[model samples]
Target chain A: MAEAQNDLKYLPLNDLHVELGGKMVPFAGYSMPVQYPMGVMKEHLHCRAQAGLFDVSHMGQVILRGCAYAELAEALEGIIPQDVVGLAEGRQRYGFFTEAEGGILDDLMFANRGDHIFMVVNAACKAEDLAHMRAMLPGIEVVEITDRALLALQGPQAEAVLAALMPATADMNFMDVAVMDWDGAELWISRSGYTGEDGFEISVPVAVAEAFARALLADARVAPIGLGARDSLRLEGGLCLYGHDIDTSTTPVEAGLAWAIQKVRRSGGAREGGFPGAVHILEQMTNGAPRKRVGLRPEGRAPMREGVELFASAEGGELIGHITSGGFGPTVEAPLAMGYVPAEMAAPGTVVYGELRGKRVAVTVTKLPFTPANFKR
Target chain B: MKYTEDHEWLSLDGDIVTVGITEHAATALGDVVFVELPEVGTMVSKGDEVAVIESVKAASDISAPLDGEIVEVNEAIVDAPSKVNEDPLGEAWFIKIKIDDVGAVNDYMDEDAYNDHIG
Candidate 1:
């Protein structure tokens, strides 16, 4: 165990997390805090009620720079299905790298940062994503940002807590990105987060990362949250976790992420279908995918977690689908799950059964985002 | 009180042995979200999985410690699973089984031994 722990990388705030009573565990090759002394349930509720601070430095941060913004965006359009060229400067959009087949390589958030394109991919898929981008975009510089640590301050009081430190934050709207000065350091701040709440994701220099985190936690409303609550928060928000919810085998259309695909990239539009797997992906968009991701609310309390098979009836039927991500939703105050099912059975009121411990439990197909998002439009 | 390596604590009174998970086990499990206990009068062999405990992170099962018939099951923890984390050794006692051989309790670890095992 000691030898294995040695192989895991530590975050910039590892000591701080340990001092705060965080239960450190191995995740994505990093020793990250899964929960703190307040536990997962309270941490999840705290994020929804007030504000929670998260250390998300393990995620990959990269800068794709070319001769100009247009060239960089055009080159990126060849890899992803999002409207990169049309993205306004100082704005971010949710997108994914697609494979030759119609499956997602990795879901990512990219911003048009005026001079260059900044992208953040999932931690586990960082190496592959970096390699893929470097291989695909020949002239573009796919530089990974290794000198910064990322932190997300999420919830209703997030803006208030952050704006207290930097007044300019109050003026930014959701998906808006800005390089603001804080304590003599340039902070890459974005009014965006995974939790279904108004928040900010700041990329701070590694030197001042801990200080910035401590400053935020000094607020009574801002508590230190860990990955456990982070998972439940995103799950409740209907956001996808890369490997679990959406993977190399799942397409953006089948994962219910069609909204992220702009019309400019879709069929019958200018700059239509230049990305990888454009033919199959466009076909799926024009017609429909065989299966689709949907929200599920299991009857009673037992959560139908990942790998639990779904059936058409309580007694027996061929396995229709399996849970991708699921757990007790603290904010929703019930057990909720997200999984892929046949498109015909993906309607909001459809009833499916998930086999739990050999017995089939009734699960109703519900709408995504078990809780309403409170974004600052 | 006797404890098993599995972290379950058993207290014997006459022929009925009251069972509950140790506080150490509860702490390790984090916050308990749901618990499904066995029904009363169910015959269970030693090491048979009898109860299910679901926490925020994952799920675990409690096994029958001895050959016995479940006499009573705690409904409180079932209604409020958080009680398992709050009072794991008190009100969160899972079941009371009427075992045929009361001497079986002597084979398990005592309080001090269980503490050393966890240590």
Candidate 2:
């Protein structure tokens, strides 16, 4: 298949995906591989049991630089909800860009790389995210690295596969960032991943992207994964996919992401932080968080797919919520989903019913991270 | 032994025509993650929905090539859907239908013609 191009752009590995017999689809503007030769189910399972590689170069990688690390952090907190002011050097935090009405702009990962905040965010939301940052942190500079390719080597053998190429990187723990020199490329390597597995996300220049991808695949242990598998893999891991799970309309609290808010940031008049939705967010944090997010395990052979209606109480069940992401989890060997219900029914062990084809299917409210997370913390 | 233009193969010795997805079709479908079987003794018409086959992308309905009644089903694909991806023409038969008119098999394209059409 020829590489597809639109107003956005294509990754350097886009041609490689086509050459590898991948079914490419347009996602977030760039033509992306949705499934490859092994297909989505096998790829999903393979990533769970072994290892799979993903070309996530479409996501915008940015660098924030201006002043001291502390000053830069403070500048960043002007827009985002995380207490960037308290972020230690060389440490990373998961955070959100919030709107005034307590809605999330986008969920992202931020790393304090000593001098600047090195961050990666969803491809679909990158434009707005970068603009939001530039507008909010006027002193700090934001650079969009479009000439780069991001690949995620995710699963149990992630570190091992990466270790073959970068010896010291393999030793890095989760959320740690190390800029290592590989083949004349100053690639940034992070022991981080979306799948609840041990993995590394590498940022290589477009020129080296395909070669690096080929090098990784040369190891019989690594397989080329596509977007379809990526979705299922993250879903099985109980991680949220940006558009499907959270968007500008959803709040971090309602999305069950209150844990990411630093306790100090929530303290009233603490450092007088200027962040979006800080007031409402602190209120939600101080008082109990309403409408917690929970994992749902449906009891049956049929899948309680996304957009399916959820109900509270078993008999004469009242419609209360809807599934955001749902699928048959090959790893868990059952139908699974992530969605929201009333705060009361969001607790683990709560019994609820999902209406599929007008019949109420039995489901049990379960804790998030339904599958045990294997991140190398 | 016969094939349909849509790439379904059937071999009939009597009223029962052993059926399975064609190799070409299976290869295109990639890995089959789920296979739904029609109940035995259920009446089926030519071009009627006989079963459901789900790959990683989405579930698709498998239609019958000839009018018949389902006499047996290959439940094996339900347990191991990848069997279709590996050996679609041999072991991944969704169902065997008792043909209402054995002559209807003639309506289906032959292997040579089916291959030509598929190609």
Candidate 3:
């Protein structure tokens, strides 16, 4: 843990990770656990079959408080591609901060609690995100929660385990939010996660973070998970990692995120544009982009990783595109990958070749979610 | 018995010494998630990384303790890498080799020497 510890600040549960016998590592600029005593494989299977608790305190938690929540929403809608203004109270939605050229800045999670919006951004991009938010929405009070700890309880059994601690949490549906009292401290729980399973991302004050973590882990079904299984689990779900899938070079349309940009934002009808990349985003929405992000399922046991070249199998391996994300899916029991190919070659069942270690391996452009996602409805 | 500072234990039988990662090395690598072993007949040189073993966070290369021709491999390690962590000395032996010199085993560190070398 000494060599793995980062100079960056740690969450309240940092000691707990050490107690759980985690092999800590530096990830996204934070010292986090890569695996626990059960190891990566066992932890991965546990998340799928049962529930796993993750300490994700490094992510940015912004509390937007002001009288003009609608005004703030409209302003946020300008920079991101999501239908934020149309979001109802107590609901969560996914969207991204776009670069001025329509490139994705970062993918983020937003929960609209009517009076204020509690937003969560990736750990790596928290600083840049805060600066971006401040630059775009002047006078809108946004407080970065540095003294808080975030935890994710994921998998099918996650609900039952969390329900035991916070009984009211059981009634919360998917992509919903609830302001609950956890041992007296306020906790913001979102019914969402990245592992393609039913789970909740909880934000608790640093003072009560450890107690909350232990309380949930008291249930037999819940186990403390690390970052290794977390990566494999999300990869199997076909979810895009911030740096890998959606980056500053990719646009919402190019990343297959056009659906996130509501029609109202594009048309400038009701709660019209104001965010950073709105102008370019609306243009992309009106006129289809040149290339869009699509999923790829390579036919072979070999895993296709990011930056692996993709080519047409017919033209003696003519260069088509490259893979962005890929891995061996434990659930699907096969290797899968995703990448941006030529629009014509992006269809599912389209035969493609992925060059790995210089050999062009056969691949198929198949539907995403190689494994069926059991997200709670 | 000779061993590399990397904690590989080599046992010499004639001009051959069985090579395997130490328990310390296996535990440090965490779970034995994936392994890429060299061909059985490939000629390996001293200090050449002939095998790739990956855990969740790090990947380790098993070096040839001394120059030798690979004679046999422990396929059970490939079947279940966790054995490397559980029984590194017994069932998780990586590969056996016909060494270039029977005396090379004397050059490697013994159990006490390796224990101190790691410290």
Strongest candidate by lDDT: 1
Better of 1 and 2 by DockQ: 1
Model 2's CAPRI class? acceptable
Off by over 4 Å in 1: A1-3
| Candidate 3 off by > 4 Å | A1-6, A266-304, A309-320, A333-336, A351-360, B79-82
lDDT of 2 by residue, A1-377 (tens): 34344364667887899999988788888888988877777788888888899999888899988788888888777778787878776667888888887888888888989988889998889999988888888877899878888999999988788888888986788888888988898888888888888888899988888888999999888999998878777887888888777776667777888778776666664754367877777777777566766799998555666788888866684778888898777788777889888887888899888887557888898887868889898
Clashes of each: 0, 0, 6
Candidate 3, A1-377: lDDT as tens digits: 66545366665788999999988777887778988989777898899999999999989999777756688777777667677778899999998887777788889999888888899999999999999888877778888988888999999999899888889999999999989997789999999998999999999998988888889888889999998888888877878888888898888877778777777666655655565666776677778667767777776455677888888884474677889877656566566778888878777888888886567788888877766788888
Query: Which 10 consecutive positions of candidate 2 chain A have the poorest summed lDDT?
Result: A1-10
Best by TM-score: 1
DockQ of each: 0.86, 0.42, 0.35
Pick by DockQ: which candidate is best?
1
Model 3, range B14-62, lDDT digits (tens) per residue?
7778888888888777766556678899998887888877664455688
Worst 10 residues of 3 chain B by lDDT: B51-60
Native-referenced Cα lDDT, model 2: 0.81
Model 2 quality (TM-score): 0.90
What are the per-candidate TM-scores when only chain A is compared? Answer: 0.99, 0.95, 0.94
